[model samples]
Target: MEPGSFWTALIWAIVPMLLLLAAIWWVDRYEKEPLRLLGLALVFGGVLAPAITYALDRAFDIATSLSSQQIVPEPSLGVGTPLVEEVVRGLAILAVFLLVRFEIDDLLDGLVYGGIVGLGFGAAANFVGIWNTPSLGSDTDSSLYTSLISQLNHVFYGAVIGLALAAVRRREFPILLGAIWWVDRYEKEPLRLLGLALLFGGLLAPAIAYALDRAFDIATSLSSQQIVPEPSLGIGTPLVEEVVRGLAILAVFLLVRFEIDDLLDGLVYGGIVGLGFGAAANFVGIWNTPSL
Candidate 1:
């Protein structure tokens, strides 16, 4: 490991990846994750995972040193190296999971965190891969390119694993829906009517809103979220969305007049509709639900 090569590799690797991570964080339109948490995840990926991977790889090499076949044919580093690296990276991704349970603002937020870990992991791996290669000194430019390609591969795999790991937060949709049901207390809306409202509010109405929004967007060149009854307003998506949800409930109320007895009944039914819509919209989920 030449000192010059190591510094060159480290600089090249860290700078580009940090920029990419910043881009990912910036492109997040709806929610901005805390920079503190993002920075923490980057550290976990770049430092912690690489150190652990090195240790594990060394241990494996030592464990297999005395093997009869000289560690060549049966279980070579080819298969084992990637496995070990990914598992270590995965552990780092898991560490990220612990940092942002409550702060995750969107589904994309989870993906951004996963991406941060991956970019960091890839960046750090380049330090090792590029420094060890003798060609890094003689063929600086080409070596840097190859190192970049390798890092991209690492980033790709790590991001994928991170995306998969993001799903493990596990939210139960019915919990809040059930709470809203409990709020009716007296003269509860019929479950049949509630289900109708839930599905219509959660699924059907949103589709209608999307179609209308898209139609306006194409005609007016406004953002999809901005295109609607009020083109000047960018919050049209939510406006239309809430109206559609209310219509679904009103449709149910009209169809089942006996069930909606008073203001309290309407409130309970309306709350359920909103919860269903929220669950589908990614506005609320298992991670953010106030269970109590």
Candidate 2:
């Protein structure tokens, strides 16, 4: 690699991630975390955690390569990387959480802090990836795109774990929500409203929909006295679920029209409603899971 290539590749790698980190900072609606602590989290992710991950990765690579057995099912370098990365990164999150537990006012706070660290980690990882990319001859566009997308995957993983940790600590809600929550660009939506939307989708919509389906089943049973597939369980589910979520979105739209200025803003609400509905569905699928 050329002497200047490292700096160039590193710049290409970290800039986009820095912009994302900036966006996360912007969306942190309620309270801004301490900068010093945030920086520490960044260092832990970009420097400390990655260093540990690299060491572990190398060892794991050697061990897995030497083993003839398919120890990990997928058994590639990638299979165990998430476990190694998340553990080190989770510790980074834990340090920040411990140092500034009082600052974490809400779940979003956890999202922001954890996201920052994740972005930092992603940037470093991307730099390594880009640095190692076999020169695709003159054009670096492909390498840059691959690195950015891969960086985003890491960011999502890190953010989700962070969000889950926050949910666990507060015991407020489940992490059934998707990483799309971060897509609210400005992330101005209140977490409580989002939670409410999820509840509406999960509980009320399902209840009404299920009732209507049961009525349909009884009516069909009495008249036809026959059925294939028992009316296909929740036959009106999609329509009813959409309508219920649409109502929730409309209610939220009316309530917070100011926060949702554009289509993307509206989408954030819609997405949350969808996620809430999904979370509830998953919980109903597994009744014993209290976390759900």
Candidate 3:
């Protein structure tokens, strides 16, 4: 590759990853973690977690083939894909949690970890997507644009999911402990509502982005029909996704009234899960595409 092209590809890879890390940092404004651990989490979540997931996926495939359940073969989507993938990703989170339990001081920690995992996943996926595009030689501009947009979208999705997991974990713990009993009786109700808000906000970010993109396309088409054409902003979907993600973080604040520790834990955990999924998806995308 030419030096210019290599630099462009490297930038394309690093920028989205950095933006994701920054967003995760912003969400955990309450309890700031050491930069070293954060960087460590990012490296592991981005690099190692994906490799582990890939290995597990292959192992599962072999296991399924070896099993002799001829009378009742497992449905591909129901029994095979979702179950195996979820387990593989969940194990990645579990491994990190075990090794760095001390680092995960609060719900927000969960969000951070989840975000790191998602970032790693998104980076890997974007690299593959960019590398596989046949238009790279003929339509470099369009291909680069597409890669950037996809990377941002993936990062936003991962962050939202990370936030949700963190908040839920935080709430579950206080309930398990005797902390809630000492607080006002009405506190728990509000916390539960907050958790729900986070869940919905996180899950809906991608759908909202999809809707906005469709709306933008329609608007652009209508504009072209008139004498004068309106310019495309390209900001609608990302803005909406960010709003939803921010709301999730806000929900975490309102729902978890205990010490900041639980919040950090939830934040990091959610981030790890999102990261793992993003990485797995990236790997799949790479494998499916034509090599550079």
By TM-score, the best candidate is: 2
TM per candidate comes to: 0.50, 0.55, 0.49
Point out where model 2 deviates above 4 Å.
1-4, 62-75, 173-292
Q: Is candidate 2 or candidate 3 better by TM-score?
A: 2
Q: State the C-alpha lDDT per candidate.
A: 0.60, 0.62, 0.48
Q: Candidate 1 residues 1-292, lDDT tens each?
A: 2323767767877777867776786767556777799889888988888778767756775222111111234355466645777777877887788777776544455567777777887787677655555542333333454455555556656655554444345431223222554445445567888887787777776566556656765211112212123233333433555567668778767866777665456655666666676666554223334444
List, residue by residue over 22-121, the lDDT tens digit for candidate 3. 7777877888877876666666656665565556545654222112112222343245543443344445555655666677666557767766766666
Q: Which is the better candidate, 1 or 3, if ranked by lDDT? A: 1
Superior candidate under TM-score, 1 versus 3: 1
Ranking by TM-score: 2, 1, 3
Candidate 1, residue 50: how far the Cα is off, in Å? 0.6
